[model samples]
Target: MRQLVTVSCVLLLAVSGFAQEDSSQPRPFVEIAEQDVKPSVQAIAPIDDTNVFFLNKRGQAGVAKFSPGLSLIGWELYSKVKLNSLNSLGMGPNYSLVTASPIEITQAFDTAGDGSLDFFQGLVRDWQGRDNGVRITAGPVADSNGRLLFALSPFSIEEGQPPLARLVAWHPDSEGLQTVTESQLLISSFSVGPDSLLAARLSMPAYTEGYYISLTGLPSFLADSPDAVPDPLPKTLPSLLIPAELTGGKEPTQMCFFGENNQTKLVLTCPESNQLIEIVPEKSGSQWQGAILLRSQTPSSIESVVEMNSGLLLGGGPDGFFPLEIPAEAFRIESVNIAKDGIVLNFSEEVDRFQGVKPDSYTVKAVSLRGDNKTLMVEPVIESDGKTVILKTSEIGKGVVLRVVCQNLPSADGDALFNKTVFYTIHES
Candidate 1:
């Protein structure tokens, strides 16, 4: 009996050690089922915290559902669709898959009319209006009303010919797929605003510079006659374009609407100059007039901008995703004045210390009446408030054409200065 008791104690201690060792081990970053497949995921669309849909590079698509701890609950791969190129993916109501591809955009059906589903060819319209060929770049996005909207630009490979672009709306109908819209702008990006109005960024090869166009008082269509052609968009509807000066001479890339119903506002992203612009309808003007609200800096080039429950998700970076909160007001140069002792540079916000703030960072040129340019050496001093910088130089005097070139000046958060050159004629005072 004594031998048996000692053996039992030893066994109990060994089991306890094993349990402690297992408990101390760390868990995996994410848990997936053994049957879960792994694909080369290029883009991910979050249906919710626990559900996501992904599109792979080879045109394969799948939906993944996860539990609270990210354990895979279900995974379903859809039938592969042959596409020339796939750009974006969206989910419509009833788990319908919406994609923007080079192939003819269509609903799931026997497109071949052979009484069988075989992904073979797309419907292409040639100059003769027959199915032949054309290259198209399009992006499809689903709206709240279970409709798919596409920004399509069709171009030919032939040299020196640029095709027109337009915005198209697709709806399900008994006769067949119904399409509508009369926009002639080359839409880079767009979003549905309040009351289902359309807001789009229009730019093209002919004029690379972009601007905003908003459509108001658009009419609704309930099932138009199949035989009749869709009516051309009415011109009397109020359309507004944000001023070009406010855009800093750069093209607007993507945009989305913020807020709900009557409080909605449009936010545009400009990639060339790294700017986020906001525009709101003016209270007491024609419907076409809109006032600029803010223009701020963004850290990365944005390809897609989507508003979510938490905030905005900016995609098309090396990391594939970045969260954008409401940015703090940006720092900007307010005024430049010629003082008795030095040149006073006033800023809208506190300036940060960087290589740009050094006196050597500036190129001071004194232009003579004979078109001679001479460099001026100076020393920079930051004021106590951090909003003012004084440049002391002997080369600044009466009748001198003073040109200050400031470059690479960054804010505390690393936002570079936008405007580089400041010119002034120093008069006797």
Candidate 2:
């Protein structure tokens, strides 16, 4: 066996507590630190410190071995084996998840204390529908002793009916593939942990009902091989988006992001078209809760804000995000379709509020003074909270150009006090 260890270090200099303060900036921002990443070979099915299988997107199946440093040592390819399945290989405590796909296809990787790769490619004859090809996607979960467990799933679609999905396990020793009992679930994305397996699934019609799952099982199949490891605890992850609550106007009305803690995060929508509620912890013990709004700034076509879990918010200007604060009062308008609606001087906060300008106000106005200026009128729909405004147009012309502006934005504080402007066009087509 080969062993390799790598470490990294960073240094910074700080002044004494009596250091003079810089009036240029009042608030201090914490630096986000990240650990250095390790380097290694990328494999289709990587197991333990010794075994790593490679895959060919061109449809070939094979396994490759390398030294701890990642130098290729040897390889075995089964070009004759047709790839009806695809997935990233992973390992677990007793058993590992092998060949996971959108389908419920799976195999439990277990061997009788022997260090050898031997097992049947978990397959279900009727797994895929008649019209679809038979493909099983498998990936690694974990490795214990000389064995590994793999998550499996099948993918197929049919008309007049929701697709079917199943989960199975595969062993690498004497016994080949053995079917494991699984819930009838529609899995979309998943990941495996040291003691639990996390998965995301959507109900029929895709958006109706969604959920997350955390599962653990025994090493040896009690129904088949009782001498194996005992089953572990099961935990379920929560869905990123909760349709019932969002549609009903809950605190976190819309789900904007959902994902595993520390490892990764996922954003569900655009911020400009949607609101970015703060990220919260989930009860599933493996994910975070997020909320979003569904308002667009452009001509309903140009997306303004992008919601994401990590990195930074995209396209919110150099400071990120247009203002959301608006007047709360309401007003009425005659029609919906029209051209240049005239210059509406919208602000980030209510026009009559006494608290002074808030840190999150923004605004946008018309593109030109001519065209349809005389034919359109601008009025506040929610004047109190400054959320939205109404523009009545006499007719639908070529296209309408609207400009957006912002003020008192927290991120843009020291740079500029004046609100900025952006343009959006309205079209009949």
lDDT of 2 by residue, 1-429 (tens): 000001010011023332222233323221222223211212244443433444344323444444444434554542334344443444333332344443433333323322222332333223333236433433333433333333334333345543334333334331333333233454333333222323333333444432232232323434345233334423222334333222222222112223332422322222233332222222223332322122222221111222222322222221212222222222111011222653233333334332123323434344332444422333323334442233333332433434333343322123332223333334223
Estimate every model's Cα lDDT from 0 to 1: 0.50, 0.31
When summed lDDT is taken over every stretch of 10 residues in candidate 2, the lowest stretch is 1-10
Task: Write candidate 1's Cα lDDT for 100-171 as tens digits.
Answer: 655354323222333222332221211211133332344566665555566555432244644435444444
Candidate 1: where is the Cα deviation over 4 Å?
Answer: 1-46, 49-87, 106-137, 151-166, 177-179, 208-212, 223-232, 235-250, 260-262, 271-273, 281-287, 293-295, 310-316, 328-429
Model 2 residue 43 CA deviation in Å: 7.7
Model 1 scores what on Cα lDDT?
0.50
Best by lDDT: 1
Q: What's the residue-level lDDT of 230 in candidate 1?
A: 44
